[model samples]
Target: MAKQVAENIQTVLRRLQEGDLLPVYLLTGEENYYIDVLSDFFENKVVDEVSRSFDQTVLYGRDVNMDSVVGMAKRYPVLGPRQLVLVKEAQDIRDWEPLMSYLDKPAPTTVLVFCYRHKKMDKRTRLFQQLKKTGEVFDYQRIYESQLPQWITDYVESSGYTILPGCALLLAESLGNNLSLIANELSKIFAVLGEKGAVTASVVERVTGISKEYNVFELQTAIGRRDVVKCNRIVNYFAANPKSNPIQMVLPTLYSYLVRLMIYIQLPDKSDAATALGVNPFFIKEYANAAGNFTLGKLASCIGYLNEADLRSKGIRNAGTVTDGEILKELVFKIIH
Candidate 1:
């Protein structure tokens, strides 16, 4: 009954596959990969398509209060030996005291799964405490940019596909936080490659339509080196392939990098500061060298440029139609100049 934190999505699935059918399950996170996987797992294990009737129910926590959830959970299973109850988007619920009370003595024949999306329950909440003590809890935090390669490799391997390390990072950057979309993309790529095939950087490039030669990372590198020609070329490349190399994609990563640099600037120019920022030590070494090239004022200006670019990308600013190349060129000029 000790609190178990499922740091990895696969770890939670392994537990479920091992038949760790707890009476109550509380899954909450921004990552939908874990939520969707668990929901599907419960749907298959708890209710068969032919047998699903009164005993199986899927409810949204937003529309239904704790009383409604408790009421359904308390109900006896019909002709079926067990009841399957799933509460999706549980973050929408206002109050959960009633639900917590019911967890004290959950119905023996009921499997209640509460899938909280985009947020987590307050640890101080009684039900959360109870879940930590008795129920299964899975927390799927987003994988960091650096760790994404290994994560993708493992994910693809688990799904009966082999991906080269270089292609893994390429996929991670291309797909970003959209795991479902990434999976779908990979599925398509795999189908095109056929069985017993390995995914190389070039093969991934050919199938996914994201070139390894010119990507956001390279663009950032170009900007960092103040190579105007390379920067303009990358921007043009993105403009030519806006679907795969969207403008919105670069802002988040650029903003994140600048924010980290600002944070690093405050700390002593030492390796520990980079380590504390959770960046790669090599990047830290780079930053240690690069930090001197720009002032706090310049970094702040870069952030402003990213912010303006982000707004323009979202169509919030720069109302007139403008090419992605122009926007990116302006952005690069703002930071570099």
Candidate 2:
């Protein structure tokens, strides 16, 4: 499903570039990245700059109804081969039934685009089926977190930059699977690199201010090694900059790490540990090395501590006010002790 959504981007872009356009482009999806990409093209590239002033119309869903949208889309271009009626936030337009009539016989000389972002149109509805007959419909779901690293790597290379091997994974770790946020961060990296250069951890750290020594992954490593000093150092970094490393993000990561460690310990064979853990094989050694530090019982205890810390962070049954730093410090002490 994700792959199909990705393929929709280039196909639609190619059609636009070649001046082969459909009447209605229904870009509805959970992932707004591709929707915005196509929407931007329509707004900037579809009509010539001179013609756009006369022919192109941009509408927000909140400001217009489906009748208004259909009315604009029905207009013929005054100065170009095609007119553009772009509707941003089409998801917010509740009068969808009014546009169904327009979809049956849309204006041939107008490219009507709906950026129905962050929500999908009901595929079972007649409106969706009618859209397929009248124009292109792209429903892009968000990509998985596991797929983000390769996506980042591909995006950088496509933009004429080289990204180091684990650097993509590191970026994925720090940024999660939010493509827009990742893209924004990559832009910062690109600005520093000029035309093109290799993206390394140092470069990422330098541009994004997400330290190589003080992210959630590093905190996991510190905890795995039972290095109390290193663990506290990382935690302090997170505490000082809580926005970058929120307690919500930290608790889940630690809990997942401990769960994976417990799973690694019980695996009879070590060769398939990476597959089992849903992690890259190169980092399996971290789990292997940490196996000696945590028995099954200890792993359980650490997870319990993580759960307790999570509750405390939420202010559930807590005796007094405790800072995120204090809760994390207390959790680490319990884990490594």
Candidate 3:
């Protein structure tokens, strides 16, 4: 009775953008990114701005009772063909049985939309079951970190930007789970790059302006060289920007770097290390200097530290109550010592 598939929120919104009207719409979720957008679409599309003053009514669940909502739904539009009755924060209202009775015989001429933000309707409740059966219900769930890369690619392609898989993943790693911010940033890149232009890693680093000198790249370099001081400095900067540099982004990047170090640690000493690693010649010297400083065990420990750092960022168990800056400081100390 519930729409439970966790996919792009855009799929439901696209249907609404196509302009077909549903008699009842229920949008309930903790993730408001999609809910808010879809609600606005219905409100604007169903009523004219001028006529909305008289015909379209938006009610808060806490302020008014269910009787008031039923009255609004039963009322005819003033000179308009249809009416919009929107209930925001519908999760706050109690005794929804009366509302369910009205919904059983809801007016054909009235469009009712419920914005239940940051919570779910009780599945055991009859009103919830009836609403699910009769109306279009949208559940906005957060996408997982693993799938974010491909999602970013699809999002960019839809906006007319061609991005390589690695580039897409890099942006996804840098931005984390904030789709709205990712979309906003992608729009800026599209405007600057134009069609037929591919988004590259360098371009991403440039536009994102993630501090090229002492950033993840530099941190990796420091870790590879076993320079604890340099690693600490770069990591402190990273901590300072945790909102932008979420642990979701940091863990994967650090993992990838340490894994590469593990591989390099196993290889025999070679004059042409770049050719051995299949990397650009420019990176050969960097890896060459770093190869001797790391061991397989040490690299494994670094990976463990990255995982712990990630958990700390997420506020999981064993996570010390440290600010983002403190977390970075501790990570650097662990890696360095």
Candidate 4:
């Protein structure tokens, strides 16, 4: 499923290169990566620079209504081969009658692109069905957290760089599911590596300024092993550097770790643990040991402690002015005991 979705975007790029242009493109999706790619292609590539000033009409959904959008699309290009009308953040558009009517017979000289980010267009609407018949309509699905490592690997290779599976997993676990930020961070790494070089874990750490040893993953490991000293060391670092290690972010990682640990405890089969947990096989033994230290009931209690910490961090049910570091310290104490 991931392969097919990835390929679909590639096919669109391939088609664009071949000059097989669609009259209108509806790029609405949960993942803004592909939507941004397609929108950028049209903005910078589809319209030549010389005529772009005259032919390209960029409008935001908040500023313009369907009437204005249809008005701009229906106009003939003065200088360019085609008029490119791009509507960014098109999810703000509510009324679609004027655009729907125009799509009934869209202008041949116009290429309309809609970048509707982080949302799905209602397929039940007449406008959606009409656009499907008359133009390109793509709904990019959100890539899950478990699928990020492979996605990172594919993205790196596509950009003429090589990364090991473990390094990719590290990136995936650290960055979570923010594809835009991940892409930006990867760009920084690639820029430093020059035309082509192997992306090592050390290179990633140094280039991205991510202190792997002091990160939330290490904290999770310490907590899992019931290493009170190690856990406190990391927690103290996190508390001092609240800007980087915000409690909101730290809480989520700890919560996810405990939940995964709990799931690991319930799994009857241990051979396929890595596959089940979407993690590297090398870490399975570590998790196993941690799982031994933390029973299902203990894990549940830890999660509850984490929830309480989150509420306190947000000033909900917090009896006094509790510092983030103090809240974290209390939570860790509860989990460890």
Candidate 5:
């Protein structure tokens, strides 16, 4: 399923570049990054600059209805071979019946694109089913946390620059799974580094202002090695900068790391552990060592601590006036002890 979604995006882009344009595109998904990219491509790439003035139409779903959209799509181009009709925020369109009917026999001379964001069309619905058969549906789901590092590397390489694995890991750990933000930050770094130099941890820190030594990645390493001093130091640093390192982000990342460690402890064959954990082979050694340091029982207890910390961060059942730093400090002590 994952492989197919990734390939679908590439295939769509390739088709667009090669001029094998689809008449109708249903771009709906939880992730808006790909939807924006592909929809922008159709808006800019489909019509030539000179012809777009007459042949291109951009509408907002909140401002227009299905009948009006269909009426415009049925019209012929003024001075070009085809016309481009793009609808942004298509999820706001209340009536899908008319659009589905139009999609059944779409105009051959028009390229219609629906940029539906933040949600997907129901497969069980007649609209989705018919569109699946007639037009192209690019369902852009959010990439998993495990797939993020590779995505960062691929995004960097595609931009005509190289990034080290450690640099990618730092970006992933600091930025979490927000691809849009990551892409923006990488663009800033690329602007400085240009296409020739490699993006290192220093470059990431210099450009993005994320510290290399004091981050979730290093905190995990410190906990895995049972280095109480280092753990406290990183926790203190995070506590000092609550906005940058919120207890909300810290707890989930620590919980995920421990959960993966617990899974590693159970696997009989450790050879394919990296694949199982959805982590890079380069960081598998850290997980292996952490698994050795902490037993399944300890990991389970650590998860419980994480849950408590999460609740405290949300002010649920958290008595008195405890700062986020205090919560993290206490959570790290519990985990390491």
Candidate 6:
């Protein structure tokens, strides 16, 4: 069942190239990046270039109704054995019943693809159930923060490059979980570094224009060690570059770090600490150090400080003239002290 859903674009394209085409595909998800990739592949790859001129049809949900889609799907190919009917923005289609009925007896020679972006189809619905029975349904879920480091490593390796230890985590911290943005940044880095070199932390910082010395990851480490001077320097850098290091983003990450530290302290089995905290084993030492530095009571108070700092960053209950830099300085001071 996992293999059937086609998690990666390469799998779907490989199947298509092998002539293992399905009659219908319902590609729906919050992640539009994968949906766009698969939908574009079907548009351009499913048929030969010459045959596509006559056999391919692209329809949008806003511009056409379900009847038009069914009508398109039932048409015979002009120059080949197969035809491609692709519907983009499928979530906008209000009437799915006609499409569901069409899926029940879809044309044998036509390949129907639906690109539903920004949301998923309800699994309990009859339409989704019918799709499962008759065609392919790929659900593209957003990558979680904990999964980003490994994902980055895999993506870099797949692109024929290797990333040094901590490079992936640095990129994940700086870029967050936006896959498309990260991919684009990686493309630039690869283009500059060429194919053979290892992507070190320095390489990532240089190529992506994110700071290696003053990033949130380093700041988190500094706070864990109770190094007030290091924290002050990093926060000062952040204060100088407010656009690069917004208080809103920093506060949440810091808050999350403290919360995870609190959890690490409470767990009975130290062996399972990394798994429970959803962090890599390599970084377990940092959490261990943080747990030692902060008692459970102090950890709770730090979390409260972060909560209040978060509110102030958003201009909620914030007094006049407190800049983001000042708030960050104060927050770091409180945490370090």
Candidate number of the best TM-score: 6
Alpha-carbon error at 46 in model 4, in Å? 0.7
Report model 1's TM-score to 2 decimal places: 0.72
Kindly list the per-residue Cα lDDT of model 2 for residues 205-236, writing each as its tens digit.
99998787888888888889999899989888
What is residue 51's positional error in candidate 1, in angstroms? 2.0
Greater lDDT among 3 and 5 belongs to 5
Worst 10 residues of 4 by lDDT: 1-10
Each model's backbone clash number: 0, 0, 0, 0, 0, 0
- Alpha carbon lDDT of each predicted model: 0.76, 0.84, 0.72, 0.86, 0.87, 0.85
Greater-lDDT candidate between 1 and 3: 1
Among these predictions, the greatest lDDT belongs to: 5
Model 6 agreement with the true structure over 146-250: per-residue lDDT tens digits: 778777777788778998647788898888878888889999989988857788878778888888898998999999999988999999999999999888778
Candidate 6 collision pairs = none
lDDT tens digits by residue: candidate 4, 1-337: 4556666778889889788998999998788888888888999988889999999999999899989999999999999788899999998887878887788889999999988876777799888899899998878888877778888888888789999876787787778788888899999999999999988888889888776777787888888889999999999998888887788878987887788888889999888998888766767888899988987888888888988889899999887788999999899989988
Write candidate 1's Cα lDDT for 1-337 as tens digits: 0012223566666777776677888887777876888899898877666667778989997789989998998888886778888998888889888876788898988888899888667778667889877677776666556566566677677767787654675687777767778778878878887775787877777877777778886676666677788888888888788877777787776677677777887886564874677644546655565566678999998998888887887677777688766898789878877
Candidate 5 lDDT, tens digit per residue, 279-309? 8899898888887789889888998888888
Could you tell me which residue pairs clash in candidate 2?
A: none
- Superior by TM-score: candidate 1 or candidate 3: 1
Query: Sort by lDDT, best first: what order?
Result: 5, 4, 6, 2, 1, 3
lDDT by residue (tens digit), candidate 3, 1-337? 0112223455666766676777788898766767777778877878888789988999999997888888898888996888899998887877676777877888888888989887778768788788887788887777665556667777766666677765665566566677778777777777678675777776776777655455565667777787877877777777777775555656676777677667666778766654455443555567667767766787688778878877777787544567766766787677767
Could you tell me the lDDT of residue 226 within candidate 2?
95
- Ranked by TM-score, the better of candidates 3 and 5 is 5
Candidates 3 and 6: which is better by lDDT? 6
Give me candidate 2's TM-score against the actual structure.
0.91
